[model samples]
Structures are given as structure tokens and as C-alpha cells.
Target: AEECINSKIHEIKTLEQVIGKLITRYNVLEENKLKSLVNIYEKMKPKDAARTLNELEMPTLLAVVKHMKDSRTAPIMAEMDSIKAKALTVELVTRNRLPFATAGSGEGDG
Candidate 1:
């Protein structure tokens, strides 16, 4: 019985270590992908990027734009459809004001 308990504890510890590594890797990958998206948007022409960005999911579009500099994003926003631009602006504004909002921190969100 003692042997079994020791084995189980060891397994749990190993699993925890693996999970920690996986989380670190995932965070790195996400940061890299965001940087890539920012670069792509920055280099693309404003109107072209606006059209492409409008087709992205709102969450995705926001993620890309949120990392970008104001100088890079302004021209793109100018080229965007007014309604879409306004809606995104509102979300950005809200996010800035409530950076720690917990409105949807429950399970099943992912």
C-alpha cells in the first residue's frame, strides 16, 4: 500500500511539472503569434488591412490591434467601415477602463 501511494504521488508530481512546461510554451507561442500579426498589419496598406481585419472574428481582430501602436492602427481604423470601427473603438475603450473585469470568468467559456 505504501509503495502504491508513493508511486501515485510521484506520478502526480511529474504530471504537474509537465503541465507547467506546457503552459509556459503556450504563452510563448501566443506572444509570438501576436507579434507576427502586429507586424503583418503594420506592413499592409491601411485599406487592404482594414478589409481583411473586418473579416476576422472580433476577438481576433481586437487581439491583433490591441498590441499595435496607435500610429500603425490609426490609418487602418480610418479605412475601416464606420460602424465596425466604432464598435471596436468602444470595446478598446471599455477594455482599457476595466482591465481587470471578471464578467465572464466562469467555466465553459473556453
Candidate 2:
């Protein structure tokens, strides 16, 4: 009985390691996709992008904003609805504390 239990434990540990590896791979893929989306948004006109972005769910918008550079994020943000912009800024600065918060704070944007 003890030997059987030990074998089961070993199998569980191996499965756990495999699960961890899969999760890491999934995260890398998700990051890559987010980067691609940000690149597309960067190339778009801010007002047009803002109009499109306004329709996205908040979590998706959050991910896009988090991945974006200050210059790319700023104009779109400027064109967003005022309440939405304020809400997103609060979420970004307070919740995530993403580097984007400080990067554009005293902007001489390029």
C-alpha cells in the first residue's frame, strides 16, 4: 500500500511540473499576441483608434494600454471619452503601477 502511494505521489509531481511548463508557454504566447495588437494600434490614427478602443471590454483595453509605449498610448487616450480615460488612468496607475504611469507624466513626447 505504501509503495503504491509513493508511486502515485511521484506521478502527481511530474504532472504538476508539466502543468507549470504549459502555463509558462501560454503566458509567453499571450504576451506576444498583446505586443502584436499594440503594434497595430500604434499605426492607427488616435481618434479612430480611440473610437475602436472605446468598444472593447475593459480588460482587453487594459492589456493593450499596458503593452503600449507612451507616445502610442497618449494620443489615443487623449481622444478617448473623458470618463473612460480617467478610469483607465486610475486603473493603470493605481492597480497595475505599470511603468507607463511615470514615463509620460512630465511628457516632452517625441
Q: Which stretches of candidate 2 lie over 4 Å from their true place?
A: 97-110
Would you give me the overall lDDT of model 2? 0.90
- Top of the candidates by lDDT: 1
TM-score of each: 0.82, 0.82
Residue 81, model 1: Cα distance from true site in angstroms: 0.5
Model 1, residue 26: distance off in Å is 2.0
Please give, for residues 1-110, the per-residue lDDT of candidate 2 as tens digits. 99999999999999999999999999999999889988999999999999988888888999899888998899999999998998888887777666566677566844
lDDT of 1 by residue, 40-105 (tens): 989999999999988888899899999998998999999999989998999888877644455668
Model 1 per-residue lDDT at 64: 94
Candidate 2, residue 24: how far the Cα is off, in Å: 0.9
